[model samples]
Target: MEKNVKQIVEQVIKDVEVKNPGQSEFHQTIEEVLTSLIPVLEKNPAYVDAKILDRLVEPERQIMFRVPWVDDKGEIQVNRGFRVQFNSAIGPYKGGLRFHPSVNLSIIKFLGFEQIFKNSLTGLPIGGGKGGSDFDPKGKSDNEIMKFCQSFMTELYRHIGPNVDVPAGDIGVGGREIGYLYGQYKRIRNANDQGVLTGKGLTYGGSLARTQATGFGIIYFVEEMLKEAGKTINGQTVVISGAGNVAIYAVKKAQELGAKVVAMCDSSGYIFDEDGIDLPLVQQIKEIERKRIKEYAVRKPSAKYFEGNKGIWTVKADVVIPCATQNEIDLNDAKIIVENGTFAVGEGANMPCTNEAEQYFLEKGILLAPSKAANAGGVATSALEMTQNSMRLSWSFEEVDEKLHGIMVNIFKNTRDAAKEYGFEGNYLVGANIAGFIKVADAMMAQGIV
Candidate 1:
């Protein structure tokens, strides 16, 4: 923490220090936002004068539980589950619940903290929250998944509702995972509460365009920026990281706009298809076929797959969409990316780049959009799902998609305007930090001190 900023916030700092023994990720999230929002507090005296910072950083509720289920061999497996409802001033707690092996309280808190601002930037009525577990879903049997989800929801259903914390999906938790969780929620609650969850199967209460919402939303935001700058995605060579849901849709939309997606990756390795990646093959493999990205070479024999731990940042391109995990691209990778003529980086995942990587981009005047701003599409659509549920009506695919486009466009403009106001001139971290801080901070101030 910086001395001057820490000095001003010493009281709140002490409170947090006493409460938290060693949750580094959670502390990092808080320190980052608190360090940046000093200017916001200066202008909005109600924020500082009222101690809004303290309240905004704390979670409204944190739920922790154990999920015990029988695996295929009739073996008992126990895993921890968590949900950190970070805020509710703007709207209900809306976010995703990942089911990866890496899920933890610290990670969820960091994600939920970032979500508060991300949801605010969408200009939608959604508050920040996130949940997940350390349960590894990979290679798990369908029966095991059903049992695990049922056991997880057995305890989780008590904490969630339509107007309360509504979790969708993240990393390992997708439509299938959401379906299992939703089914359990319904069975336990004995109510057909459609609003209790988002990211359902379209055959059920799922919204249209929800599948491609986050990925398409990234392109939608970039398109708005490009339109304002009198440029376009047409003819741009893009390097996209990750072969997941967000990355696949980003590739599809960029190609639709005539951009050439040259690279994409997975945990095993990255693939570079100079002739342009086949978006359909990617969709088929990752989504439908449910296989590794190395299969891409099998489909298109010309595609090059580089094994080992390397990321996609080494690819030379005009735009870099980091759709991978946090810290996937570091300072060295940032330099390589900038040296390779990369002009913009739109984060498709949460904190995919390190602080140094971000600083390198900002110093070089690259168009760096933070994950909170760039990847709010999923939660934004989740909010739309809640709206439909509350109204007892479902919107058509086109309707929800158009609304998504409008919201993304608005978010881009807000970030741009905030940057210009802060003298950061297109520094999206500052822009997004300031823009999102204002709304929640104001609401917190008006509510008065607790």
Candidate 2:
């Protein structure tokens, strides 16, 4: 690290440590962003001099509150909610709200911090923010889940708007949560503000191809990458972790592009079907049934459900998409994937690969696409959704899909150019950081220091 960077990092760490008191997740998020921006600092000394790096590292605003709701059994339930509006230098704060048992201030901050760069990488007119709750919607009745989302959004709606902050779905916060939350926002605001949200049902002003954008976008970028690598998804065996919307969609698109998806896992475990997963069956079990991956195995007797944490990364395949959670694939797992002849790794989840795991791939000359660039399709299409809402028009699926494809392609081009410009050769991680930070940093400077 450069002397100035080390000093800046130390100062920020000291301030965060004093305020957070042993919050490792927040530290990790800040560290990752700061570490990746060294080249940016070298390229643009003004950013470091203005302390823009420090300010960028810290969020502009963070909202935390207690969400109390009634369960199906009529018991009082309380879960924490948070919205970290990390940065808005480029545009309005835009990101997603996730609801899961693991959500917390630290986690949400990390996510928002990451989104600052991720949204920037899309080259769209949007900034970055993230929010959610520790409320687990799993096994909860629809009514119970609706009640929780209502409670969470009642506080959140006041802090967000179409032009201020636009949040979509993530992880546990899927269509159900978005629907409940949007309903609450509409009720409270008493206006037909469809622009206030994204990820809506297509019949209700949502864009077509929105559901398939992220997954398809991943494959599109990977396709461009495969061409560069002298390979293709056609006839390639793949192992994708996480059976959530992102993972499921990635599987469908990868298969559509002629790859064979052999595995998908949930929190419970992984299900491996050598016959290639039935997308419809996987959808029914996950989207409709909200069940575990192991259930997919029972339905197919020949399949195996490794009922533990380490089920993925152990599988041998040509490509591995870690769509699960942060740090789900570490150095050991990366070594396993590399040893298993895995040539490509695309992150569908934010920060899914640990630094060590990423290093393993970089050292081995493996093709790597970070989540910020790979999964940016969701947010890019989201910006299009916002435009449609503002214009009082809805585009057909083909229109939005074409626009999304163009944006993803452009994102790859920008990332590639950034890498080459920075002299890092094929380092997309550094490329993405530098490319993303420059736009936001320039905007922040133009807007004057706060």
Cα lDDT computed for each candidate against the true fold? 0.85, 0.86
Worst lDDT window (10 residues) for model 1? 1-10
Q: Which stretches of candidate 2 lie over 4 Å from their true place?
A: 5-18
User: lDDT tens digits, residues 1-450, model 1?
Assistant: 235445776667567757876776677667766766766666556555576777776799999999999998989999999999999988889899999998888889989999999999998878889999999988997889889999999999999998888899889888888899999899888998999899988866888888899999998887776676677788999998888889999999899999999999999998999999988888889888789898998889999988853657788899888887877888999999999998888888998887778888989988887888888888899888888878878899899989998889889889989978867776778888899988887776666664
> What is the Cα-based TM-score of model 1?
0.96
Worst 10 residues of 2 by lDDT: 24-33
Report the Cα RMSD per candidate: 2.0, 1.6
Global CA lDDT computed for model 1: 0.85
Q: Can you give the lDDT of residue 49 in candidate 1? A: 57
